[model samples]
Each structure stands twice: as C-alpha cells, then as structure tokens.
Target: MSAPASAAAQDGVDRLTYAPMVMADLDAVFAIEQAVYPHPWTRGNFVDSLASGYSAWTLHDGDALAGYFLLMLAVDEAHLLNVAVAGARQGQGIGRYLLDKVAACARGLGAESVLLEVRPSNLRALDVYRRYGFAEIGRRKNYYPAHNGQREEAIVMRFVL
Candidate 1:
C-alpha cells in the first residue's frame, strides 16, 4: 500500500485508500457506474476486464467507495478503459488521484504513453484530462452510444510518460 491520498470533500478531508478491485467490490462499483453514467459500461464489462487480467482498482475513503479505474496495457502503450469518481465525490481531486495511480501503474508496466477516449460533451472530464497533460490526438467517430439510438464521437487523448 502507498501513503493515503487526501481529497477535500464537502464534509471534510477524506483520506483515500487504494486497493486492487476484486469481485466483491462489484456491487458498490456497479452502483456508482449506474448512478454516474447514463451510458455506463455494463457490469459484464467490468467482469470481463477482471477476467482478462486488466489492471483494476478501487479507491475508498474510510470504507466508503470513492472511485475506481481500469487500465489495459498493449505493447508500449496503456489505455485507460474506464475511470469514475462517485457523484458525491466529484471535483474533490479524486479524479486526478486516480489518474496519478493509473499512470504510475502504466509506467511500472513499461508503457511509454497513456491513451483514452472521452465524449466531447464531457467537458469536466475533458478539462481534467487536459490539466493532467493529455493532448487531443484524434477523434473516433460514433464511438460511444448516445441517447435515442444515436452515437457520439469520442475525443481521443494521449499522455506521454
């Protein structure tokens, strides 16, 4: 385990604990995903990731689920498959904390860069990625399912290690 990371929430400062996510955490993690995203990744997606041995982790603030992230490494690059902070825990620097952890994990795996895709309308996420040194690399058309049978494009971003 690493030193606890702190995030200032509305209640006070929360000391975050990082841990490898397991099957047992799925209930809480899935709840967060359903709550935070209209087009959330299915629970099966998470299960598959774990089954495939991707890097999956959860963040907790004193037994309270705070956030989670999934990373997939391919050759010299790492891809951030999914990352989310609890709705109540957003804007408290937890996203960056998760990113920092994921980046470290990638680097440890010998990845030279990290890549991700974000919906263009996800302004908050876009800002976070940019602030964390990710740059727009390209766009993927119709990459994300949208409301009413539509599809949304994805803004691809890359962060070099």
Candidate 2:
C-alpha cells in the first residue's frame, strides 16, 4: 500500500513518504536495528510479525529508508511493538513522527488507546514517550533481557486515543 508523503519536515524543506513494510525492506530494517540495539530482533522475528498480521510501515526520506514502526491491533487497543529510526536519522524527530503515525493508525482501527512497553534503561525512548503524552501505567519485572545476561524491568506506557 502507499501512504502519501508527509508535509515538509520540521525544517519545512524535506519531504517524507510512508509505505507498508515488505520483505525487500527487511535487509535495511535489520541493518538499522542491529546498529541501534545491543540485542536486536532477528529477521525471523520480523518475518513472524508480518506473518502474524501485524501492521508495519516504513518511512522514507526521498529514496532513503528513514524509519519504520509496527502496530498490533488487539480488541480495542493497539500495541506499539517496535519503532526504529536509522542511526543516521535518529534525533531528527523521525521517531516522533512514527509514534504519531501509529497512534493515528490505532485510532483508525477503532482502538481506544496505544500501549507500549519500553525498557527502563531506554532513557531516550522513555523521554520520547513521555513527551508524546504516554503515561506509565505499570511495570513488568524482568521483562527485557539485558546485555549482562540478566533481565531488566519493562515500563508499560500507554497513550489513550
């Protein structure tokens, strides 16, 4: 599917486009994921997510892959499973763009809220979520596998649509 290009970037000059994720985009997606995370999701994980009917979309800046996000609609809520902006594109508000896009998708799907779990250690993401109006609802203990072979707690956050 095709999503119309978004209005100019925050700078008011660049244009962005959105498209449904395809297998062909996996290589780039994996590369960005691998670069951004200490423990990245394998290609198989992405494949399975697609096969399970999750909604995934990629954002592009001209011909370059800028970022991507995944949304899973369940009952009346939508879950934000993954959102990653290319290393080079991080800190440019692309992540925030993806968050807004997915939340709009959730609303279109008849969802009342958008829920996501972020590692407590992911300070960057925590800050973004907070700025995006996601409130911490609860925590999942030992929910994330840490690099030290130990588990880290996950902070469950939600944005009521």
Candidate 3:
C-alpha cells in the first residue's frame, strides 16, 4: 500500500492521514498498544476485530504510526471500541482528529450517535471527550481491568450525531 501523506511540523501544523488497518500493520500497532496502556488489548483481540469486520483505521504521520481507532457500527449507533495515540504524539490534537474521522465514518454508516466507554481514571481522555460534546450516559460496573487484579468502572459516554 502507498505510504500516508507526509507530515508537516512547521508552525505547529498537523498533516495526518489514515488508512484501513491491515494484518501487516499489526506489529507496529501492537507495539503502540503495549506502550500506551497498562492493560492493552492482545494481538488476538485486534485479529478478531479485523476478522469480525470491525471498522479499524490506523493514523499515520508520514511513515510514522501516530495513532489508530476502531469502531463497530450497530443499527443506529457506532460503538467506539478502541482509540489510541502514540505516547510521543499525545496532546498534539491527533485524538481530536481521530474523533472527527470517527464521527464521519459513523455518519457514513447511518449511525445517529457514537458510544464509548472510558476508564474513570483516564482524566485526560474524559476531559477530551467532554470538551468534544460527549455526555455521560451511564456507568458499567467492573468494565475494565485494574491494578492489583481489581476491576474498574467504566463511564459510558455518548455523542449524538
């Protein structure tokens, strides 16, 4: 596949592009997953998502893997299964860019809203989602793995399209 468009770092500009995730991109994607999360999804999880035809996209800054996200479209809602930015690229507006793309993709799929679950401890992500117009809709008990073999609650959020 052709490389993504080159990134332009001048004047704090961002030139990011994304492509559909493929099996060949898993090594790099998994590396980022391992680096970014304490309870990262396994390679098998990603493989399964692809096999299930989940919508997965990998963001690139030129040739560098900057980030990626996955979505599963339901009848009228798009569930955001995963979204991540490389540690080095966090806080560079990449997350927002990815979110924008996610909304576009969801709309294209005839979704009326986007739904996701976020760890309560992920304050940074929560802030981003709130600022992007997502509202807390509910909570899920023991939704995520936590430290010391405990479980963490998930704050379910939704953004109406």
Candidate 4:
C-alpha cells in the first residue's frame, strides 16, 4: 500500500514520522531521486549503501514515502550521503525534519559533527544547510559529473552535532 494523500499534504506545523527503509521503498525513492536530481544515484549505489550498513531512513506519512536520507557514521563524525524530498513536497519542512533527525542520531552516536557535500549550483539546498548551521569548509574539484562530460565542484559543509 502507498502513503495516504492527506498525510503527504499535512499542514506546515505537522510533525513527520520517520521509519527504517525497507526494500519495497526503492521504487518510490528512486522516482523522487530522479525527479529532483540531475545526476541521480543508481540502484546499485542504494543497494550497496544498504548492504554496507549505512543508516537509512524514509519519511512516511501514513505509508506514503515523503522523503529519505542516508548517512554513514565514522569514528567521530557522520557523513550524510543522500537526502531528498518527493518533488511535490519540496519547500516543506521535510528536508529540515530529515536533517534534524540526522543531527539527533549523530549526537546519540557521539559524533562531533555531520558532514555533507552539495553541488555548488544548488542554492536552495545550500540555503537549507546554512539555516541548519552548516558552514562550508572546503571544496572537491570535479566531484560531481556534469551533463556534457564536464564536472561540477562539490561544496563540503559541516554542522556541529
């Protein structure tokens, strides 16, 4: 069964519920990824991340997948691998909710910070990260593949947990 439409369209102040991702969520998650990103992650990548023990969670509103996030915990930090909200759900607080959840989880795991890479061109995402107290620390050259065989730089940002 899919998520209820009413849940997906909850009012701005409603709290979101997050749950562990199951294999059945891949199809919906992949659809959102493709809709929201230029260069989307492949199914194998998601599978590998899951298989490798990455912490993966999906935001749900009564069985509907609103969004998902993946993070990897290291000795003293947590690396945010991927985060996306369904196309129709952007600009809602879902992204912030996901980030907040990750931050709490990182703190619980004794991580000092949370780190993530964002495409330099993604101003919206950058703003979201900044609002959450993430500051740019460095850049990785040619980190993300671009459309015409060129490459885009990735801004590395970190937030204290």
> Could you tell me every candidate's TM-score relative to the true structure?
0.92, 0.91, 0.91, 0.90
Q: Once model 2 is optimally superposed onto the true structure by TM-score, how far is the C-alpha of residue 87 displaced, in angstroms?
A: 1.3
lDDT of 1 by residue, 59-154 (tens): 988878999999999999999999999999897788888899989999998999999999999999999999999999999999999999999999
Give the distance in Å from residue 99's predicted Cα in candidate 3 to where it truly belongs: 0.3
Which stretches of candidate 3 lie above 4 Å from their native place? Answer: 1-13
Model 3 clashes, total count: 0
Number of clashes in every candidate structure?
0, 0, 0, 2
lDDT of 3 by residue, 112-131 (tens): 99999999999999998999
What TM-score would candidate 1 get against the native? 0.92
Q: Is candidate 1 or candidate 4 better by TM-score?
A: 1
Mind giving the per-residue lDDT tens digits that candidate 2 earns over 1-161?
Answer: 64334433464224778899989999988988899987789999999998898999998777778999889999999999999988887777788888889988999889999999999888998998999999999999998889779999899999999
Error of 2 at 35 (Å): 0.7
Note each model's CA RMSD in angstroms: 4.6, 5.4, 5.4, 4.9
- Cα-lDDT of candidate 3: 0.90
Q: Scored by CA lDDT, what does every candidate get? A: 0.92, 0.87, 0.90, 0.87
Model 4 TM-score (2 dp): 0.90
Worst 10 residues of 1 by lDDT: 4-13
Looking at model 1, the pairs that clash are: none
Greater lDDT among 1 and 3 belongs to: 1
Candidate number of the best lDDT: 1
Output the TM-score of candidate 3.
0.91
Model 2 scores what on Cα lDDT?
0.87
lDDT of 4 at 35: 90
* Deviation of model 1 at 119, angstroms: 0.1
